[model samples]
Each structure stands twice: as C-alpha cells, then as structure tokens.
Target: MSEPPPEPTSIGTWAKRYYYANRAAVEAVLRPHGLGSTQWAVLYELTTSGPTSQRDLGRVLHIERASLSGVVATLVRKGLVEQTPSETDQRQRLVMLTDAGRSVWKKLPDPFAEVRTVALEGVDAGEVATAIRVLERATAQVERHSFG
Candidate 1:
C-alpha cells in the first residue's frame, strides 16, 4: 500500500512567525508616533467602528479581558483614547478615540499600505483568499469545539 503524505505544517506555527515579523515592522514605524501595535489596532477600530464597549472590543480582537485592560489603560493615559460608561449599560466601559487617535489613524494608511503591499507583493490573490478562508474556518471550528 502507498504511504500517506506527510503531515503538513500547522498554521499556528506560521501565524506566530507572521505576528512576530509584523510586530517588528509595526514597532519600527509606530515608535516615532508613540504607539504600540495593540494601541494602533485599538485606535483604528474605534476610529472605524465608533465607540465600543471594552468587553466587546476585546472580543472582536480575540484578546483576553485582562490583557486589554492594560492596553486600554495605556491608551487612556496617553490621551489617545477615553473611556466612559456605556449609555445603555452603566457597568460596561466604552472606549472612544480622541482627536489624537484619529490623527494617528489618518496618518497611518499610507505607511500601513506600504507594509501591506510588501506583504502581499508576489502573493497570488487566489492563494490569499484560500488562506483566509482556511484560517477563518479553523478558528470557527476551534471556538465551536472549545466553547460550545
């Protein structure tokens, strides 16, 4: 009988490397702007999605509530973000981008686009689409199996 093909590499391994490499790039670019990658993502999300509950933001970003607490605290202290009680729920904390946050987001698209272009350069669109599909499906499966 023919042997089965060797097992493929796990996506988790590649994802770790991808995160590390991109984090490096983000640090180089954002250092002058006085921001970290997490801070940038928070600011960008608030800019695009308007205000959001801190819990909701953590869920959307797939971050732990404990980790996001520190991230949000840093942003708030930097004056890049402000937290208020949700109008609809007094117990929930809402975070909104400050003017400085908006300014940072507005200025980022160009440099971010540059990085994205480099990342996507020579990558087949079809392959990229398939990879995204596979990753999302894997994530959904994990969540369903683990949480539900």
Candidate 2:
C-alpha cells in the first residue's frame, strides 16, 4: 500500500501556527479589557505609526476590506479610536487613536511585557533575536511574493 502523506513541518507551517497561538494567548488576556486581538492590533499599529489611511491600516493589520469596518466600529464604540476624513481624499478616511485608546495602549505594555516574559521564560535572548530575524526575513519574502 502507498504510504500516507508525510505530515507537514515546513517553516511556513510552524510560523503560521505560532502566529495563531500567539494571538490566541493575546486574545485570552486582552478580551477582559474589552478588546480582541485584531482590535489591539489596530491600536498597536496606530500607536506605533501615526494616524493613517483606513486602507493602509487594513493592509498593515492584515484585515480584509470587508471586515475592517466592523473592527473600526467596535473601537469607535469603545471611544478608543476616531475616523476622520483624509485631508487629500474625501473618499478616504484616516484612523487615529483617541486619548482613550492611548490610555489602553499605555496600560497594555505592562501586561504585554508580563506575557512576553512568561512565554519566553526559557528561551534565551539570543534565540529570541534569531527568531525575530527569521520571522522578519519570512515577512519580507511574503510581502514581496504578495506584491510581486
């Protein structure tokens, strides 16, 4: 009889697994704060970068166009974000973190640090650095592949 297909264990598979698992962990901790992972991700991006176009934010957050509306709506309900018309394009909107959003983000650093510390407790900093490098290269590859 032909052997069954070998189980997959490529870098991409492992990376995606880690991505989902990591987000699950974040969601578990963040949900109590009235935020989901995607919402936090949106806030994080806006906090790190400045106010940006909804399309650009969606692209960076990996949120599909159809779903981003709901995400923004939730944050708006929470009074954590604001959407204003883009200066250049009336058709486009820019999303900015409100004072409330910044407040939540500021508070998040401590819990997030604790989570990181727990998750990486056994892994050395060197390993973390290497893993980051690997992930960055993988991200660049994916971005190039997608855009090209």
Candidate 3:
C-alpha cells in the first residue's frame, strides 16, 4: 500500500483558513453596499493613498492586471471611481475616488474592527504583537521574491 501523505503544516493551513474566514466576513459586510472585498480594497487604497497610478495600485494590492482592469471598469461604471491619463506618463492611468465613492466610504461601517475583536477574543496583546511581526516578516519575504 502507498504511504500516507505527511500532515500539513499548521502555519500554512492556519494562514489560509484565516484568510478565507476573514474574506467571508468582509464579504458579508460589504455586500449590502454593492462591494466585494477586491473592489473595497481598491476603493480603500484610493481613499487612503489619494490619486495613484493604476500600475502602482495593482502592484501594491498584488492584483492581476486583467482583474484590476475589470474592477476599475466596474467602479467607473458605478461612478465611484474616475481614471485619468497620468500627467507624467500619458500611457499610464491614475485612479482616484469620486465624490460618491468618498461618501460611500464614509458611510461604510468599520469592517476590520469587529472582525479583529472577534478573531482575537481571548488572545493576549503580546501574542497579537508577535503574530503581527511574524506576518509582517512573511509579507516582506513574499514581496521580495514575488513577480506580481
């Protein structure tokens, strides 16, 4: 008989589980406002970062070009985002939130706080800090080697 496969590592399994769980919660919160997690992320970035180049946004968000294009198109159609040719580079597009977008962003409930509270219910502050540090290092390492 074939040998059984090795057990999955806790870190990878938990990371993926956490992502899906968090995504579901975020989706539930955003759906009523006609937004998906990806779309909300784009809007949130524009809100905090001011006008940003489309290429840069994709890079920062780790979004594929095709997916980003579709999301931007949908946001544009909804009148929540405006895209203009970059002043410095005509080939590049700059994306920013419209007044409507800002209004919606203002009205949307803070999604992360509730999720964080629930997820960290019994977790201590030091544990949280350690988790954050580990995740940050992992993120930096991933970014360093990432092609997208």
Candidate 4:
C-alpha cells in the first residue's frame, strides 16, 4: 500500500497555503465582475482614501511598484481609474477612481467579507482572535527579519 502523504508541519507552509486559498476565494468572487484581488484592493484603497500617489498606494497595499504599475495601467484601460501627475511632484502619479469605478465599486459586494464568512463558518470567535494574533506576530517577525 502507498504511504500517506506527509502533512504540512511548518507554520510558514500553512501560512502560504492559507494566503493562496484566500486569494483564490477572493478571485472567484471577483472574477464575474472582471476584477482580480489586487485590482479590487487598488479600487478599495482609492475609494476610501481618495486620490493618492502611486508610491503611497503601493506601500499601503504592500504591492511592489512594478506590479502596481501594471495593475494601474489595466484599471486605466478599463476606464475605472485615472492617473495624473502630481501638482507638487511631477514625477509622482496620483491615482484615483473614476466615476465609473465608483459606480462599479458601489455595486460589487465585499469579496473578503463574503469569503471570510464562509471560511470561518463554524469557528469560535475566541479561536479566530487567537489565530489572528498568532499570525500577526509571525508576520511581523518574518517581515522584520526579511527587511533587516
């Protein structure tokens, strides 16, 4: 008989799996609306924060500048967002949601909220809180080490 596959034992492995699974779930929810998770995140930030420099947006979303450029370009092509040179800093681009983008955002349900509801259907509130705390600590440690 074949041996059973080994289970994931490392916290990092589980964290990665959780990230991918959550992303996939969000993508599935956004796919019908012709949006990806990253695109949705950009839109959400713009909607909430109004116009912001591309540099700031990237930092807020923890997305690399190069990847954000492509996402912004795609949003521009879709007529959902517009980017303009900053009046104070001509080298910086300010990105904001167009009227069409606002309309779309107003109509689309919150993908993360929807997915979280399903993903945590039966989990206890305390357990969820503990899990969140543990993960947040782990993420902070990893990021600290990574950037040092």
Query: Which candidate should be chosen as best, given lDDT against the real structure?
Result: 4
List, residue by residue over 1-148, the lDDT tens digit for candidate 3. 9986545766656788898998899888888989888898899899999999999999999999999999999999999999999999999999999999999899886666767788899999999999889988987898899585
lDDT by residue for model 4 (84-144), tens = 9999999999999999999999999899999999989999999999989999998888778
Q: lDDT per prediction?
A: 0.84, 0.85, 0.90, 0.94
Runs in model 4 deviating more than 4 A are: 1-7, 145-148
lDDT of 2: 0.85
Worst 10 residues of 3 by lDDT: 4-13
Which one wins by TM-score: 1 or 2?
Answer: 1
The reply for model 1, stretches above 4 Å from the true place, is 1-12, 110-112, 138-148
Give candidate 3 misplaced runs (Cα > 4 Å).
Answer: 1-9, 136-148
Off by over 4 Å in 2: 1-13, 110-113, 132-148
Poorest 10 consecutive residues by lDDT, candidate 2: 109-118
Worst 10 residues of 4 by lDDT: 4-13
Kindly list the per-residue Cα lDDT of model 2 for residues 68-147, writing each as its tens digit.
Answer: 98999899899999999999999998999999889888987444665777778989899899989998998888888956
Residue pairs with backbone overlap in model 2: none
lDDT order of candidates, best first? 4, 3, 2, 1
TM-score of structure candidate 1: 0.75
| Full-model lDDT, candidate 3 | 0.90
Per-residue lDDT of model 1, residues 18-93, tens digit only: 7788768767778887877777788878987999999999999888999999999999898889999999999999
Which pairs of residues have clashing backbones in candidate 3?
Answer: none
Clash number by candidate, in order: 0, 0, 0, 0
RMSD (CA, Å), each prediction? 5.2, 3.9, 3.5, 3.9
Question: What TM-score does prediction 2 earn?
Answer: 0.74
Model 3 lDDT, residue 74, Cα? 97
